[model samples]
Target: ATSVRRGLRSTLRLGNRLAEEWWRQGIAWRAMRRGEVVVFDRHFFADYHAYDIAGTDLPLSRRLHGFLLAHAYPKPDLVIYLDAPPEVLLARKGEGTIEALARRRQDYLSLAAVTTSFEVVDATRTLDEVTSEVIALIRAFEQRHGAMATTS
Candidate 1:
């Protein structure tokens, strides 16, 4: 068990490093620098281990990696968490067991709780409704930040 855990941790570290590098050179970073409203389908925060698995019981390296990944990147101006029941998520994705989906949902909710700029939208709603709500959130953010002006 210890060996398995060690292997997982090593893999996670490498994956995190690669992901961070990619993010630094990714479209999101470029758009942000250009003063555009970036709509990420899934952001870094969404990928971090949640509070449940992020306890001190884990190795120091694992905990440190989680901490750095959670804080390293520039935070999104608005985090619209489109939340739905685990069953709904399972149905939509056609992958993952209900148990796994539920765990992921809890992780997302935990992350949302600690985020300063977070909004939960009912993702089970009709596509139009969800899109409208997301648009409204974006508009509100733009209003607060002034219209996003792209750099030429």
Candidate 2:
């Protein structure tokens, strides 16, 4: 009975997560339809991959669901990965085990490897430095895409 309850709970959680992803996709599409730039702080595919929820250990149904969601979801125009060493991350964030952070960093890098519009920025620098680098990247992308630069 406990096993059955756990299964039911996991199933429910999966359903809820799917609904959230779908809703987020809808919002992105709507914003793009209006010619608005949609920026996601954290994307669903990367989140799932980092958390290992999309890994091969799950039952076939869950794995298939994750695969479908990853493939069907619209790819972002740019994915910037702010990378810092796990020790630095722990020192700065004061959260997450070093081992887990390392794993997640690797996972993110793996995803970025296959992603076309991806950039890795060193996050160990000062805030101003990091911000400047990111702005430069965005400006370069805009120029490449023929979008007028925005000053703000």
Candidate 3:
């Protein structure tokens, strides 16, 4: 989910409705059809839609918690939660901006409820370490479920 923060922020603006439909519905549907690996990054939870858009203010956080408990999204086959101490992340980010921290914290907290397909890890380590950890997790999952191989 190493995506552009600016683009994600824009997803909240009015101009992004079309982009959302294109990316979420159109793109995802096509990917599934093609037997492709559709890697959804963040906030595809149903309640993330604004109250006006969704027709009621259902409290996104609580809704997400309940949704996770019911084995939603198939737990995505695997969920790699990259976590680090706030201070470590702050040091790595340098600017120590509250806005940046807030965005990251929100993402992390939301993922905490997920468990079956999730592996929470310390991200204060090296990039190679993170990659190795993720690979091990995926391999273990594939062993259990049989690999869902894709070609392009």
Q: In terms of lDDT, which candidate is strongest?
A: 2
Model 2 over residues 65-136: C-alpha lDDT tens digits?
677666775556678889999999999889999999999899888877656678999999999999899888
Instruction: List CA RMSD, all candidates.
Output: 4.4, 4.3, 9.3
Q: Which regions of candidate 3 are displaced past 4 Å?
A: 1-36, 41-43, 46-75, 95-107, 147-152
Instruction: Please identify model 2 stretches exceeding 4 Å from their true place.
Output: 1-4, 50-54, 146-152
Q: For model 1, how does the per-residue alpha-carbon lDDT over 13-131 read when each residue is reduced to its tens digit?
A: 76777576465537665786776677778765566557313655776666666676556645556678899998888888899999998888887777666666688999999999999
Better-scoring candidate (TM-score), 1 or 3: 1
- Local distance difference test values of all predictions, in order: 0.71, 0.76, 0.55
Clashing residue pairs in candidate 3 are: none
* lDDT tens readout by residue for model 3, 9-79: 54454335434634564566567567655656643442232232232444443344334423333334556
Better of 1 and 3 by lDDT: 1
TM-score of every candidate? 0.74, 0.82, 0.53
Best by TM-score: 2
